[model samples]
Target: MINRFLQNGLQGKYAHYQTDMLFNGLNWEMAGERPEGSHHSVWELLFHMNYWQDFILAELQEENPESPKDPSDSWPGSPFPSSEKEYTEMVTQFLKGLGRATQQASKDSLEESLGGRKRTPADMLMVLINHNSYHAGQVVYARRLIGAWPPPDGDESDE
Candidate 1:
């Protein structure tokens, strides 16, 4: 039951918009544009989310990945993709990471600790879900600010 709930949260099933829905139909140009007063562009926000997602996944897999010495290291690179292809690749990678996390959540013992760390898989998964959810809202706000909301497929109501 816990695993099921974790998996659902990883997919943003009930708490908010699905990751794929929020990201679909975005072009590089639109992604690169930062709405007024926004701290980051859509591409930047996605990149930031992907950064932590990868980190959490590594820890879940017991990779013992090193924490970035500087907070900014997690948000490295340009605020936007360099081209259409780059943007597409970012989106693909982000979604793939989400899929990986969802798979991890299906494990029988989400409470099992990894690498002698006090944190369990469930702990990491919750962090990932919460982090992604926070940034997901930012992505939506950025899209709306730039007039890119209601992606080509339509809004959550259509779901």
Candidate 2:
């Protein structure tokens, strides 16, 4: 159940814009570039999205995770990455964290409270789905604004 849900929503065919696809072909420079209407760069959005999901996943696993000092601290700071490696590393970490959480779904207690919250693992997953989808949409929009849509070979900036 967990695998299927994640596949379809987080990293699967059901999602029109898969996370991998959304981040694909983007160098650190491209990710840090904000399109006209986007308030946050792609890196910022991805960091924010990943932070929440990882936080909930940690709680679900009974791990001690640090909450952000302020709500905004959860997002990456100003002055995004200057190197492609840093960008790729974050993306890789996010994908791994997501996979770990999904694998634990069937093995872990989905009905138990995590971090004193009344919400269950199922609830956390629901939050992740909604939150990820929303931010993923933003990423897509940013890509479109910069003419990076239809990823990989399509970089409209040069054309």
Candidate 3:
């Protein structure tokens, strides 16, 4: 059903790559590297993605989270993570948000309005999935540009 599809999309099933797997085998140094011609580094992308994910999740929970007044607020901080620990924390948080969103998908009526807002959980989830997917590709491209693609556990033939 629609919920199943949403869940699959959140997990990157039947898509370019599993959302979680996209970050695998990437080291802190690589995550912080901004290949020439790229505007955002891998770490920045993850951070940005997590920021919006949290925003949508709050809405889903009826927490009434405020969207940043400025668009760039969602993309705050340096383009690169400061250290291995910082990079690891961001990756962990990103995965956790994805998991939370997937769980939310199965528990809601996709068409029901959330917090009296016109948008439903389904709409928010779709936005999150599409947002993540768009950036997932960029992450891969950044990796390839930096000669870090096919993450240690991944195979070039698989893509």
RMSD of each: 1.7, 4.2, 1.4
lDDT against the true structure, per candidate, is 0.86, 0.73, 0.87
The lDDT of model 1 is: 0.86
| Model 3 error, position 151 (Å) | 1.1
lDDT of 3 at 6: 94
- Worst 10-residue lDDT window for candidate 1 reads 150-159
- The C-alpha TM-scores of every prediction are 0.94, 0.82, 0.94
Compose the digit string of candidate 3's lDDT tens values, residues 1-159. Answer: 888999999988887777888899999988888899888888889989999999999888898888789999877478778889988998999989999999988974889987688998899999999999999988888888899888888766323
Clashing residue pairs in candidate 2 (N, C-alpha, C atoms within 3 angstroms): none
Candidate 1 residues lying further than 4 Å off, grouped into runs, are 156-159
Q: What is the lDDT of residue 9 in candidate 1?
A: 86
Minimum summed lDDT over a 10-residue window in model 2 is located at 150-159
Which lDDT tens digits does candidate 1 get at residues 36-98? 989999999988898899999988888878998999887747777899998888888898999
Candidate 1, residue 135: lDDT: 91
